[model samples]
Target: MERKQIRALGRRVKKIFIEHDEVKRIWSRFDGMRTYIKLDQFEDEDEEENDDDDKRNLFLTGLSGVGKSQIGKRYAKSVPRYTEIIDDEEIDIIPVIYVELPYPFTQAEFYKEILKALGTENFKKEPTVNELRNRVFHLLTKQRVEMIIFDEMNFIMRTKNFDNQSAMEMLKKLSNQLQLCIVCMGTPQIEKLHTMEDEYVRRFGRDRIERFEKCDEKFCELLERIEKAIESPNPIGLHDQSTGLPQLLHYYCQGRIGYLHLILKESFRLLNVYEENVQVEYSEIRLTVDIIKQAKFNLFRKNDHLITPDNVDKKEYMV
Candidate 1:
């Protein structure tokens, strides 16, 4: 394989998205919330979707690498913005907006994130919190944004100086004023965010994506799905119990999808090296346990625990 082929394969592998059961379910939940803000459901696009409970806002929490941010991003991309003419003014109808909060996520920063997602100014120079908040509302309304996905919402709790109470108020206002179904996605610490305010607790319908406790049947199924999704001339057989690849992967990734993805991507790239070094056809090459082991070593050499010899599981543990 030449250098060009190797780089192409790298880019191709990164774009592959496997919509496993959990991911599909998350999309369904988000689509349902979207209906509440659609013109078909409400008399007007900005009409109130939240009743007394305000549970229409969705809160997605999960372990790191369970793909919470990916889910939000992919779902947002599924809906494309278009042009709408109102009173002879052409407004960009961005149906969904995905915003990732900056580290030390604060109230002013939160407001600016929305503007950034809308593709206007990514930052406002020293605008007051109230000023930024109002700008967010005005732009969201003008653009007719039906949904806002706030990724890394958990950072609110980790930062000491951030006024979460004020941020909560901003979220509440964003939901009610714009009739947007606000989706907050982050790690488990974000669960504490709802607990801080009783009203917020009632206002949010929460869902947690429980990661694999350990390598089990569910993890095996995930491997099978990933195998089918990979753009290879032949199957990688990641889930084949006889090959012992699945358990070995479990040992390294600990059931985290993000880590699993990284490992597989690196392993695929290794195929290029093996072919070039051996002066063999790419079609004759395969993803062997040794190849994956080397990829893991190259990837996690600094991390240490992920790249040892004794951890290799060349046998099945299915009970």
Candidate 2:
């Protein structure tokens, strides 16, 4: 196949992005958070110093590839990208500031990461912890950031020199000082934060992204969405008699959206390779399964949980 043909197929596959009920629910929660922040800002001029008003922070927990980051990015993009005026001066209001937490980050390192995410030129420069903290506070306020989202928050737990107590303290302090809504996205490990401290628990609301289980109506609906997205000459029906691929895919992917996406992308790639047409069929899906399995095995090795029966919930697929 020509490189251009392959690239075109890739583009078609990428267009298969689907937003389901879960995404809407997450986005709604973010909307509520924004409302709370706006109310806090309006009612109190000294809201930044008032620790009495509980922080309307959000914690998004899920396994990898359950679309937490996707939902976060979508919600962030929905916020108007513009500036605000304060005291006759123009202030750039970044409605959302999204930062991915680096593994094993200290309070200082975390601030530096935020600076880098904010496009600071000398983010790597050796600044004192206080200096960094001050800079972050100034930038966030000056930029008029309404919310700060930290994705991959589980890295805080995975860090070798991590101190949960001090970290929690810093986060609480920052929330009170900035008075900006904070959103944390990570795997199930972040649930540990809720148990670490009462203040921390009180500050954030938690939501989990569940996997698409086998035999569920949502699973079939997701397949239908996928079928519609694929621009194939032949109708691609994963739920229909020609394929009945939804069940097989649910089993093979262990209900992971990421895995399903990989399978579909590979299926499209295979179609491009041999058929020279965008025709997704049962044979293409079946052929792509092995490719997905092998890729998963090569990347994750023994930890390829998709192939492990234990990863699947028996109650959900027992029938």
Best by TM-score: 1
Off by over 4 Å in 1: 1-5, 39-52, 122-126, 213-218, 233-235, 271-281, 301-319
Error of 2 at 200 (Å): 1.1
**Taking the tens digit of each residue's C-alpha lDDT, what string does model 1 give over 143-183?**
98888999988787778887878777878888876778999
Q: State residue 152's C-alpha deviation in candidate 1, in Å.
A: 0.8
- Give a tens-digit lDDT track for model 2, residues 1-319: 3445445555767656678888888878787887887887567565444444554787789887777777777677778877678899877677787788877778887998888766673845688989999999898878877788888888888886888777767776767778778888888888897668776777887779877755467888887877676644445566552454566667657677877777666555545533545543433333344554554455456564644444566444421
- How good is model 2 by TM-score? 0.80
Q: What lDDT score belongs to each candidate, Candidate 1 first?
A: 0.76, 0.71
Residue 95 local lDDT, model 1: 88
User: Least lDDT summed over 10 consecutive residues: which range in candidate 1?
Assistant: 310-319
TM-score attained by model 1? 0.83
Instruction: Please give the clash total of every predicted structure, in order.
Output: 0, 0
Evaluated against the true structure, the overall lDDT of model 2 is: 0.71
